[model samples]
Target: VFFFLYIYIYILRTIMANLHELPGAQADSVPSAAKTLVWGPGLEANIVLPARFFYIQAVDSSGRNLTASPGEKTFEVKIVSPVEEFTRIWIQVLDRQDGSFLVRYRMYATYTDLYIHILLKNKHVANSPFILNGPVYHEGCDCPQSSGSVWETHMHCPQSFPQIDRDLALYASVDPERNAQEIPQRFGQRQSLCHYTVKSNKVYVKTFGEHVGFRIFMDSILLSLTRKVQLPDMEFFVNLGDWPLEKRKPTEKIHPIFSWCGSNNTRDIVMPTYDLTESVLETMGRVSLDMMSVQANTGPPWPEKNATAFWRGRDSRQERLELVKLSRAHPNMIDAAFTNFFFFKHDESLYGPLVKHVSFFDFFKYKYQINIDGTVAAYRLPYLLAGDSVVLKQDSSYYEHFYNELRPWEHYIPIRADLGDLLEKIQWARDHDEEVKKIALTGQQFARNHLMGDRVFCYYYKLFQEYAKRQVTEPNIREGMELVEQPSDDLFPCSCHRTRVGDTK
Candidate 1:
């Protein structure tokens, strides 16, 4: 038995070494025509694509000696997406070392380039008027987003088919602060930082992924604004801050919007700590607007652009400013990518005894652009698949909606989310109040497990730590690893990451 064990160990090492020896053989499961990688950087970066084999060939652009590993290592590249030009990357052959003839790309981190294709001819929209490209409009927005929407986005005139106009201006804004002085938000109305009406009938906002804390931060600010305003409006305010729930054993500050209702503490959170009051709302509103303007270079009499995006350290905190017109450009596309957003839509349920609002949340990776495709078919800088309950678009508007201002994670969750009286309809529960509690609990648990950072961080940390420690010399390891010191820069005192190779699998 001992002799066999030794032979098996030797064979495993030999296979690993020989795998690198065969240059033409691609690793198992990497793709040939590289699609977007889920584990790269930014929003979709957190997702993992299936392993495939492909070829890696790099050219030195900066005249710096190319650094790479013979086997597997993560490498960074300035992916010129529009032109498909990758500069300053070291190349290697990714082939099957399994002794099989079939070879593809695998191992290490490679750039996942996402492209948007808009084949719209000017004649279509010019000839006919349509409010938004078509979701069976007038039929009702049944998607997850529409489920949470407060007002209508468009109205269909029976006389004019296909012609749709915004039912009400759910979003509004005032420039220079003076315009806001005159316009009074209707009594019992909440406004976005941009001054847009926070409620829309055609839109049902479910989650602002990555905009606020993945664990539930920034939510209280939005709901608190209605309180700080004038008399009638203030009386209808919703208190998002929950104090009683934070007193649990672990003592976690629960965000307003959580993806998990299945968890206990994540159930319907009520109570206003009053810590995040109206002033905080105003501060958040102003700060977010500033971030947006700066990101887009929206100084008057100048073209708006992307922010000066650069990581404090490991080259990840990207801040760019560009115009929206160019955001959805195809293949080698360039959009004013200031921040990233994730959107979703779901059906509305009237089981109100406890579940007040069906919830969603963002994962803080504020770097991407959103191009609304359909109710569920938009293009993002990175990539994400469609999910049930919500059709989310990833873009600057989406990003700022929930993540602008403080950190990439600051956001608005359940505070004033328009539930449309969904909670007031729980009729058949064994216990009236208990049924409502069950519903709210369902949503909270989902956020805790799927959207919350502590939830994600714990799982990812455990898995990554194990893998990173297991790796001897692989580069571009994600944030946490025992062997690596956090990557840092003098600019942002808080921004840091682990310096490991980029993943290609």
Candidate 2:
């Protein structure tokens, strides 16, 4: 009888231990709504973006953190106006599958105070119904204005402010003999160039080439920006190509031209690309400036992602081809491949079997992302830096407006143009795991702070403001120019919406 009792006790203990090790163990550990924790920047009421975010962590009855998601429907978040109970706001709860949840909500134009309720399994979280001051803006659909006083000045723009003045100075003096007003008329008709004028905050365009889409997209951004700030009347020529217009070496003299990107050798005034600010995601619709922060916040934590370096793109440059060879030589360290092979089609067998296109978010799965220049500057650099993974960018002269602010080791790991130092850098990343993770996080924070839609608009406003200061004569709408109307909210229903309160006139 004594032996049998001992056996029974041992068997019961084993069963309990096995149950604790099972996948459903979290189910047994019921989340205590009262003990759950909630915090993050999204909780702040005065944030400039229309979207607000906060984090929630599940805890048990004993206040211990839960290791996994409790359930899909476990956490519930609701944002409601305190004064008007009927007021509705859009709210989303993203489960990180690690006992934590990211809650995002859209801010609407309302005078009353707002309250955010966080609940787990129908019970209130530790700080449920957190109160926040309503947004001060009058329009519901418009981008929220910064409450801080420094937003309009160059101080509110990126660190590239000095570069803006220098680029404008390149065109500060046109050909001494030519009239200032005639400069656009003489050079605007060139291929891949367009003349743009802002009269009373409206964008007017005259296309000289087939790249009308670029002008339309840029005008859309300008229109969105003008709604928030009143830009001085200005006219400028825009180069709509991968190469800067000044670099093209037309027989005519170099003129001040705005470009999406520029090189160290080029004198083009670089501006933000619509592709960087508002690229469309397959799952998520048009990703606007406001949604950029939210998208950047997505993806797994650093430790949970793959440790190998990842690269995927077309065969746009020889450096990219060499990267694939290096990856093949060191498969364990890197995973590089071409998704399309046009430039080197003759060597198809050498790098054949093009891989399928990977989703942008999936790129975050790797510990390090390889950013190689395609034509000029890889437009994907901004989006890559926005992710949680560290970017191993190839050194290139080509740069965007904000590249001046990005420090090499501080923001990203710089690789050689030929990718010769890439292996060494990857090994270094492996050796200093914590340091690389910090760099990744710091880069992400930099992007979130500077590359957002609001900041892009601010950069444009500052650039145009500086350009307006140097105008020799008043800008007038030229013949053949057409008005580029602002895009409607219906086009970007996911990021933009019309509130019941009314539109800002």
Candidate 3:
């Protein structure tokens, strides 16, 4: 019996040795968890944003690269939060079919360390349980305060600013002979531009425009942003008009003037409009009673809401007039009307008997909300999306800063520039009740996630950070630019003040 056992062991050893000698043999190229490598920006523990990613390359036990896929199912990746041990964060592993995998994950919770477990064939890989130190973000998803140095180095949010970055580059690439200070002076429109300067995290503004109300709100937002985070010293022009100031020309140098909205031909750096009433007021450390009322009034649920699309705004565009006419024709499907009319005052009879202004929150009483551009991209779209109703937006060339991130069917239902498809789309929405409701919920969630007060400030902070990098010359306050002081605590009703008072106790 001992002699037979010895013979069997000898035969097994000889077969294994022969297999190792053969080229590309399965027995010789088995995947080793220890040899496999994982590395990328996503592996960084200081990541504050949701989207994080890393790459995994499979290697053999002999430390040789595998040329083909070993099957994605063979690898398992998980990101587990210590606070929520039972709940595992969902991770996506995309097989490259080339012995590599791309693993993606999103951090949903705040102030919780995460453990990343990477396993190959249920065996622990090299650096298997990676502990990621979470950040402590402020209320409303503000910048993480736990690591100031990390925030300074990574001075950007997860959102992409393609157009803004492009325009910044264009402005930065000015003629060497032309002075940077002269660029703002040459393009500054007295009726639209507001020159602003930041010094030691304090914001000061000088209005070149007639829109004092708009300028005040814009500067207030800047001041509020500085209070939340330390901004670099910089000075730039902001256009408070519906139209962008910079028109790109091959021969002429383009001045990088910031604006609330932009189109295909414009190169203005777009920022969030000051017209977002709730966000603007909250940023300024103030909240009006009307805003409070709107917050409390969430409107009815999907089933209880009126089964018609609703829109009430000033007639500023031809498409808006057409919407009113369509609503009059198909009153059952749409309830659109002009609250005020200046563009077509002569044709009052055609689209008249101006409807009284409806509270912004009341628009959510209907299942669908219509968002037609007024002059430029309608600033109300963000506020409209914050409601509990789906938005049927008209197609247009104009766009805000966050427009690129929004998907048509996923976040909103798109309607043509003409009202020809309005009725049909409304009917389609009615037929697919559950789908439209989901769309409404998604749009609302987007606004809650990206357009909140803190996120808005974060966007402003990031925009200026990119702008600062592109400036050929240092930003300094110029002649006639007045200092806009921060308002006193008693002047506005602030939620932060209450927190301070409670802390003192």
Q: Output the lDDT of residue 171, model 2.
A: 67
Model 1: per-residue Cα lDDT over 1-505, one tens digit each: 9999999999999887777335443232222212212211111222211112122322122222222222222222221223336422222222112111111111122332422111112212111121111111110111221211121111110221110111001112112122223222321133211111122111011221123232122233222221111111000112222211122232332212211111233222222112212222222232221111121111211112121111110111122111222232321322122232222111111111121221111211212112232221111211111110111122321211112121211111121112121112211221343333333233322322232211222222222222223222223212221121122223323211222112222
- RMSD of model 2, in Å? 6.5
Those runs of model 3 whose alpha carbons end farther than 4 Å from true positions after fitting are 1-163, 166-169, 172-181, 250-252, 283-296, 490-505
**What lDDT does each candidate get?**
0.21, 0.70, 0.69
The stretch of ten residues in a row with the least summed lDDT in candidate 3 is 493-502
Residue lDDT tens for model 2, 1-505? 9999999999998887777556557433578888889986456554433445577888876667886677657888877775775754567786655576667665444434677788776777887778777442322234423321344542245444766876776665433124335555665555677777888667787777666666656765666565555577788877777887566443446667788988887778888865764541111234543334434344677778898999999998888888889888999999999999888898778976799998777887899999999978888887788777899988998988888889999999999988889999999999999999889879977876777544666677778777787777678887787987755555223232223112454
- In candidate 3, what are the lDDT values of residues 1-505, reduced to their tens digit? 9999999999999987788656688733467899988876466654333335567888888887775678768689877777765542446676644466667654333435667899987888888887767542222333323332345455445554565666565665433124335655675544566777786666767765456567876776666555445576777777777887677673576666778898877777888776663444442234432211233344765689999999998978988888888888889998988889798898778998887888787887899999999999998887777677899998888988889889999999999888678899999999999999889879876875666543555677778877776656566666676777766544222233112211333
TM-score of 3: 0.64
List RMSD in Å for every model shown: 27.1, 6.5, 15.1
Best by TM-score: 2
Query: Backbone clashes per model, in order?
Result: 102, 1, 0
TM-score of structure candidate 2:
0.74
The candidate that wins on lDDT is 2
Question: Which is the better candidate, 2 or 3, if ranked by lDDT?
Answer: 2
